[model samples]
Target chain A: MKQRHYKYIVPILLGTLFSCQKSSNNEDFNQIVEANPIETEVDVSSEIAMQVIEQMPSPLEISAIIKKTGLSYNSGILNPITHMENYTTNSQKAINFGIYATDLGYVNMYNSSQDAMNYLETVSSLSQDLNVSHFFNFELLQKLATNEQNLDSLMHISTQNFEEINDYLAKSQRGDLGALIIAGGWIEGMYLACEVHQKSDHKSLREKIGDQKVSLSSLISLMNAYKSNPDVELINKDLMKLQNIFNKIQVKEHTRESKVIEEDGIPMYQDKKVLTVMVTDDEINQIRTLVIDLRNRLVK
Target chain B: MTLKRLFISCFMLNSFIMSSECNLEEFSKNAAQKLAGYTYLKTYKLDASKEAEIEYSYVFSNNTQYVLTLAHELETTDILVSIYDNNRKELCNNYDKKGKKYFQGIGYSCSATGIYYVMFSFKNAKNKCGASVLGFKK
Candidate 1:
């Protein structure tokens, strides 16, 4: 009787242990990420990719530009949960992770507690799906979101978590995911910028929108690193099209000829070094339409 | 009975591995607060592996006032932070070249939108384990 029971217990125990080991590996994101076997010539080293990733502006910084325009808070722009169903690929999940997090940044800046909580949940969920939940302090973020007084703390913590996530992903084997995250945040920021321009028609905001051309170049470099991945390729392709439009927009610099000059026994740093973004209303409209169209499809 | 022992052992190993990841949020948050009135933007870590000097880059926005500061484990540090533009032009350094002094932080208001580099170096100080924070005000 003991010998016969041995076979049953041994097999069942081994199966349970195997399942535990699988989940403990934390490769859930790999399943959807490696969906495509297609190969391409484009490749970039982690060091190069990380440089681009770090060089890009923080998600909060991008959101800050939008807030600086004094644009009214519009919850309707938040990526609806219905579109989340389309996130069947790792790149999609990573991009939406950035998109939702950008929305969170925008809301926190506006002090929208209800919207902040909702976005916190979404960001947390996507982090888990991307197998990077270990970096986020969801519990602490939840506490901070509950009180308006903790808004700054909430912003800093939330930004810190995502920043760490991006840093790690850029250096890790999933460098593509990191690039996609940056790409997603940028697209959402652009979408919001376009939306804000439509309502407020803020001049500084328009210059900032034109200034995105600089960031767009960096974002493309990051995406090109992972162009071999079909999902990343799709994103890079969309950005390349946007790049065509951006190519026409010229941002001329009005920098002081001298960096520092001695005046009356004192050195003075140049005070009026600014870029004069020469973006016409027609070009702005084109950027708005293309950004919205791409943003809508990705959100869905 | 042996199966039960194997299960427990696996569980313990898994728990240990999962708990090993470090959290640097507190350190970064504290470092960012030193920016004083400027909102936090980003953080850069300088590890022991970086020899003598390390460089990092950021694409700063136009017409934005930014500050960079470093905090280390030591009570005092000689880590000098410098800011530069894409052309390798040194915009400013925390070190007072004329006064022969080194400061832990520097501030620069970007007048143009493009890539900017920051370099950190120790002045005869061996410890390189520290982090720097970047904060901005529009």
Candidate 2:
């Protein structure tokens, strides 16, 4: 009887051990699945499609332009005369000159060629031609242009100029005009950041800009208060439209890669993809509604 | 007696397995939600030796593609941006080396809508980058 009991006890112990091992394995599997999970795909709708089409800069027109003239690098070129007029009438020409002169320095740094440097020098001279003051001086421009062959010097000069400008902006109160100029400077800084990122993968423009993170929406709201008072309706309208666009494009997920995995008998997905272009119908309609609202407000 | 013990053990094991599976699914959903809601910005110190930085403001409307002013100009380090919905569903993740504009979709079936948090950071900076958020209410 004792021998029989011992045999039964051994089998029972072995069974318990097996059960514990199996459960532990199951838990491990579950943990893996949790770490690597899958996301459900959203269904894109037709209304969203229509809205997207409406907002797109007629692809046909873009394609036609491309087909007709290949690619035109002059799309972003500002009409110098008109731009200058806007610069002066909207506010002080000196500030505008200073801003553009600084921009030229950045443009020159990236190009780092005799021709590019010459072009920037011309731009710098043009700013002086407008009789813009030293308060808005292109000291940074001179430094960048003279040190065309040195990337480190160029970066240091640009950074210093930006610091000075930021200090000026902080101390001076020029209403909306100053804000607009700063906003433009931000874009120029972004341009330089992008150049830096491209030349070296060790730094990213986004990261640089990220450090100076400002709420674009909030800035627009502040500008909106001055809208009717200044009657800069057209500019206000454009800015509002821009604000809407910014809203649509800013999404979480910093990178553009995604992955999917499976654990045990279950499958899961891990999304690492950054900057996906696919937009759902709901997203499109939302943007359309916002645009229409901005247009209506501007028209009123 | 043996049959009774086997039955009890089977029941307990089934319950434990079921609970473990459910817990994992819940965790994934939570993670997705966190990713969707995350947002941050960064700014870098301007190199004074170069030109004064240009100021720019950007807005994305109706699938419009606006070029990042730095494209072809500045050397960029790390760039990462992702889009997600209110429910935490991952929409898009885009990394740009050339400072290219990432086009937001306008009207499309299955396009995502709503407020998206665009979180971004640079490799070597301690500051945050600022970005404007714009969208229409559905």
Instruction: Give the number of the best model, judged by TM-score.
Output: 1
Q: Relative to the true structure, how large is the alpha-carbon lDDT of every model? A: 0.75, 0.32
lDDT of candidate 1 over A70-120, digit per residue (tens): 677788877876567678888889999989988998899899988899889
Error of 2 at A86 (Å): 7.7
lDDT score, candidate 2, position A51: 19
**Model 2: per-residue lDDT, tens digit, A1-300?**
000000001113424431111121112222322222221111112222111111211112111222223222231321133354443344344334334544444343344444335544544454345432243345655555565465334433343343344334333443344344443433333333333333342222223222222233433433342233243334456556645545555444354344433222112223333333333345444443543443233212
Candidate DockQ scores, in order: 0.23, 0.02
Model 1 chain A: weakest 10-residue lDDT segment is A1-10
Fnat across every predicted model, in order: 0.43, 0.00
Cα lDDT tens digits, model 1, B3-110, are 999999999999876444223444455567677767877888765344667788899888787778667644434677777777666777766678776655677767
Best by DockQ: 1
- RMSD values, in order shown: 13.4, 25.7
* lDDT tens digits by residue: candidate 2, B1-138: 999999999999998775433232233223222222111111222221222221212222222222111111113222233434434454444433355533211111112222333333333322222222221111
lDDT for position B94 in model 2: 44
User: What does candidate 2 score on TM?
Assistant: 0.33
Error of 2 at B18 (Å): 70
